[model samples]
Target: MADTLQREHAGVIPGSRAAVSAAVDHLLERQDARGWWSGELETNVTMTSEHVLLLAFLGLPHDDIRDGAIRHLLGCQREDGSWGLYHDAPADLSTTIEAYVALRVLGLDGARPELSQARRAILEQGGVAHARVFTKIWLALFGAYPWEGVPSMPPELVWLPPRVPLNLYDFACWARGTIAPLLIVISRRPCRPLPFSLAELVLPGTEWRLRRVEASGPFAWADHLQKQYERLRIHPGRSAARRRLVKWIRARQEADGSWGGIQPPWVYSLIALHLEGMPLDHEVMRRGLTGLDRFAVEDDGGWRLQACMSPVWDTALAILALRRAGMPAHATPLRRAVEWLVDEQIVGGGDWQVRCAPGTEGGGWAFEFDNDIYPDVDDTAVVVLALLEAEQTDEVRNAVARAQRWVAAMRSSDGAWAAFDRDNVRQVVYSLPFADFGAMLDPPSEDVTAHAIEMFSALGVRPDAPLLAPAIAYLRGAQAPEGSWFGRWGVNHVYGTWCVVSALAPLHIDDRAVSCALAWTERVQNHDGGWGETCASYRDPSFAGVGSSTASQTAWAMLTLQAGGVGDGVAASSGARHLIDRQSAGTWEEPEHTGTGFPGDFYINYHLYRHVFPLMALARYASTDA
Candidate 1:
């Protein structure tokens, strides 16, 4: 594999395994005491800035982690003094408005020149009126915005049936878990308006009424349900219902105190509970707070919210990468990671089985800790792929076979695999009033399907098997006209194209389809030899193939090219050199976080991705013949 490829390129080529090992050691030192890693989970300026405020609210001194955060924020500010979804991205009114408010909470007064400049920027951007629906609702709670003008959220609707078209179960689990408590708070309509008018901070003549949506009137079935429930004021069995809801919420809260396994709504739910007079010392509050702390990864630099825990996910990927790098399957780090992956599997039935039964007992793993309600095929597939490379002790082989069976059961009728659910065919779930957020329902996405295909291939499952044909057809059908694939989990086209091409390589796919996909990737290669896609690509497909080069996406591209057995002398050597040149002083410099399981509205740049991927790509390329 190595002799046939050309080697000359621009980037520094890592000289030896010793250097790579040292680089890995340096990164391992940066891991938190808890055996996990995390970096920034990017959001709009307001959310990022408010995140800093939350740190302050939690008692970190201004000088603590504030300086770096402020620098990051300042770097991202628009020329108009407002902020946006990302640095170098266009100005977003809602994010800017929220960020402006957050800066005030951080003790920046409008009279201060820098603060004044930001205020002017916010006012020019249409102030709170142009902000997102969630931001306005937050303001209304603090009386900074009018409660009456905000949309209604009646708690009585909790009693709606799961089978009902508009009931809570129809919501994406993340949405349902987050919004359930928010409904309680919104129904109470608590108001503690700020002391000063925000007129100076808003655009002139901006009417609050213009931003308001009526609590009544039918649109979706959910909206009609909202109207019906609004008329009820309170449920006839209100006390019993409240107790049941609280018990249900508490029951689902992971060992770390979060519901639905992530940060955004967990924090919001905690605040809502706090506002409802749940004492900080109370068991529920304590559990939730401690859970937040558990997710917190600290360093001398500061702390970050892991969008979710990644031990099971990271360990699984690390094991696979090590095996691919030609490390012995029983290497100590590989063994430990394999053991962790095995232990993380869920034994009982979860929410996913409501659609298809994941046949094996102790079927698969979820992405977070203690989340037994859902076991995602994506994580499960990846875990199985990793275990397949481990030392085949009787226990290990059996575990791998069991995981394979579980993934087999998770295959959708159409041959694709969803993240958490099976055949989640209801697109209408996304049209609900609260569905303004990204990806509420778990439909089988392209990336997850690709992953499942790869896993089955690794397990030596024949292409003619019942499960393989549908998935292959789906993958081929899902390919875009330009040869790119739409990535639902990562950035738009680049990530999807990479995974699809790599997965298809192991299958006996049409050579034309494979070559076209490879050609598309080669065409989109950044001048820097990496690949990137902005989150906007999710909203507008035109932006799909564009963004700054990133380490993880670059690695994905390299892996795909290598797997497809395409990219002869010039392209292969060029891509490999690009990665080598980016390595700094024998270590790879981490770029802006780029591993995203969700794009645009939600972003996550897994910290480990920066280290693990570059190493895998460079090592694999170095060992290959050019």
Candidate 2:
């Protein structure tokens, strides 16, 4: 078995022990003194629930914080007694099942009425058979599902050439990192049955085979190619594949025991190692356990998943927003945040290079570790805006100038600004099955472009500035025929339209464009005084102007109107009132996850965004007559 594994990955260079040790050291050093490790900004109930599961597995007491989290979990349950990706999202069977399992582990009895409520929700939503592909894999590990139900994941595929049509590299970087260790586990197929059965929760007449086929369609080509190269259910070749996969996993394990500074891969890697007979005392196991500490954050309200780090992205934006909202440039909070931002700037390359390519020579910072591969225009632009808002000390001035030059260099030929690079013009790759992301292929989004325009315009780059014409053209082209623009990084059309109006406000673009955008926004304003659009908006333009009213969406709408000089005091004040009314004591209430930068497919509710934006909107509206 070991021999076959070695042959399968013969070309792979397993990391030297010395190199792995150094990587682990680097990861550990990055941990905050508070004994928590959090960098990946995962935005789902699964993240926080998993954190609780991990802590419980590590023997942490179920304290008040755990209770609070449990309550938070309970609060999100749908009428059907299930949970989903976001608060207001329709209940997803997969997330509901996982949350139910986690709650049961926390001492909730499945036979209890509340537990039965969740079980019933799961059953009604098509039960385990209807859950996601990953959920099935997890269930298989616990003998809740048959191993054969899962699609075969041959470890030998790791040796395929990068140029191969369905090679691992074809996957998004995050997907590849996660699927690596997962392949190892799938190859092993360890099943430890729970004491009870979930058969009662399974839907009537549901066929797991059909469910499997449906879920694999997005990556069916890769699965098919992998199967064609390797036979299934053959034990003779399995040992070698397992050993080779273990070696591959070991090589990529970051210094702190994380696979790639992300949770999905890190958790899978730890589980894989555990299955390999690596005891809890093993240095690898210890490192994996300790690595989770980096992600733990504790505040007065209790602990929650960070979704990811915010130093470069959050601090920069916070500084800039405060300045824009009239906070003094030299205020202590602004200065401290700026100092953190300036220090956090990446001076070298990062993983973004994989997408943008090396030698593109752009500038900006990423939101995570060793993320120097590409400097995002959004982060860079925000940093420039922040630095410009800081007191113009010689050091601050120098940093501002450097960031400005970098932003200028990253401008696309279309005269717009993309998130990471200037001319990443590979559209063909985006059509691949694995590219589930909506904006993964684009050069620039309206949200990011508008941000760039605002920054450049403020930097004294006028409407006639060389970079301005193409940007304006891109903005005009991006506007929907219905007059609204799509927001790639915010809620939906309202966010996009608001961003365009704000960007055009300083330029004093003719009222024709402004009126068009403003009219679209006013049209979409819900009777509830907030605005929202579902993830469906991304796929169907008809749904773009339609979503439930949400606090964050309301704030976005109000901010847009205020920034556009719309001067509808009644509307602005009413919207602000709605937002204020939604506040839970002063903190904005969590309304469905409106903060998602990626909707439907990948939902996120920035914990801070729920409060900060509404605060900004209310403060601004209250001060203005409008």
Candidate 3:
């Protein structure tokens, strides 16, 4: 099997030189003089539509950006008159409803054929009454649905201690931050009505109704009991609880006025503050609005808002790609990138400390430019790996050591690292009716574990390091029966398998595991000389490693093949050709959002992935040990 693989990739390098040089030169042009790269992080129209809604709700005057954003939403509408959550995703009920409302609010006549078609599509999907919880909450705010129809998130629940089952601290940082503000919105049941009704989305006689509750057993009982308790507390019997909840939410606000560095929490927090009687011009409220505004970008293509900004994450990944393409780490461009990364390291307490064991100064990187309250293990690992490959200066030395300590302390009892919290494994959080966006708990994942191991290896930690064996055991367990691993943050098995192979190759782990994994990835290669896995793979394993070829997934598969020692021959060359064939003027065209925000709920197109990953692949092919 190994011999066949080797022969297939033989002499692939020389064929890729021109493509490699083009890709590398293109990427070098993208770097900042001070050393960073940020491409737009694109999401579905829901993000842009929702931003319009937030701005309107705040009574902010509609500006040209909003006008451009309106055009973006209209442009993205499917020919069938519905909207989807991701590219090629079937028309989603929640997204269509949101986009339709935002358009209506922005002066698109509800009587227009475009609006009528969307309304029909939404009604066919069971109307706003059956949309996702988040969408339902938005409807309730607009007075389209009664607050009683939505799930109760009583403010008093914030009073629950950490030891309790449903404490806020038990939620992932994103969940807790977003929900804290939502609880305030739900508690007050604000009925801010829109100028016109969206009666078109409803069927002939549909009425607002609360979701039914039916559960058995103790776990189920606790869930129903919460709803029953919701009815008993008319205004959440405790004013102290409200005060503490508000204080808790406000204290975590980033310097930019976002809570936990994301849009949902910021938008919700702004609404919650207004309801709580903070004046519109209040400093905190003003900052939050500015922070959200900063996320918007308008161009000739139209306007869109990143669900979240990712300069720190994108910069690190870009550095790795450029270095792999034969740029010396000591070069000024690369060194500047390293210096910028060291400056972004987290040096103070964040929400992670609420669950983390004490006694370590905080040291890691957050995904956004200004989110200090949350720094993720995955971003930290990526940055550390990139720095190790760069010219190791004094700043890099201090940053890496601090990250190593924080990472070491964050390792779960199972020996793997989760993206956010330590020991945050409560299954009940996900089963909660209000908790359906997928990542309720921050349990360790195979891909995150692989990156941690690779980071350790890059830092020259011994193979005998305490975290190594447990993480290796984790990889062994996560490997598919057919030998692939599941990627939590990337697309699917291809991304996961690549992470494992990258870790094992450098560390010289047992060959059997690596070989089986390599063969599994190779077998799934598309006829186009690439790999493709739909996000549907999350709910159905049969779709795992199956889909139309994508530039990012193809590069990942190529990277895995090279790591397995076929050494950039036929298979690698073919993958490079797919990238080169698809790229125009140095940029690769990829419509599919390859980065996973949440498996079923959200997905992302890291616009840079197409260019960066292919460059990484072709560069390795051009520099193989053949």
Highest-scoring model, TM-score: 3
lDDT of 1 at 567: 39
Q: For each candidate in the order shown, give its overall lDDT on alpha carbons.
A: 0.66, 0.64, 0.82
- Model 3 ranges with Cα > 4 A deviation: 1-8, 12-15, 204-237
Query: Residue 368 of model 1: what lDDT?
Result: 70
Q: 1-626 in candidate 3: lDDT tens per residue? A: 56555553565433466777887778778887777888888888888888888877777776667679777988889988899877888898889999999898888888898888899899888787677888878877888876655666668779888879888988877888888888888877777788998766766545534343223456456655666766674644556777787798789888877777778888888898888888889998988888877788888768888888888988998889888888888888888888889999998987788766766679989998888888989999999999988877788888999999998888888889899888788777766667765587788998888899999988888767787888888888888898899999998888998998998876676688898988888788888877888888887898888999998999999899888886466667667667767778877888987888888878888898988888888788777635
| lDDT (tens digit, per residue) of candidate 2 on 335-390 | 76666666656655543444343464445665555345335777777677768878
Query: What is the model-wide C-alpha lDDT for candidate 1?
Result: 0.66
Model 2 / residue 56 / CA error / Å: 9.1
Residue 14 accuracy (lDDT) in model 1: 46
Listed per candidate, the RMSD to the true structure in angstroms reads: 4.0, 14.1, 2.6
Model 2 TM-score is 0.77
lDDT of 1 by residue, 337-417 (tens): 666667777877755665564354557888776677767888888888878888888877877777888888877778788
Error of 1 at 302 (Å): 5.7
What candidate 1 gets wrong by more than 4 Å, as runs, is: 1-79, 195-199, 214-217, 220-240, 275-277, 297-304, 358-362, 590-593
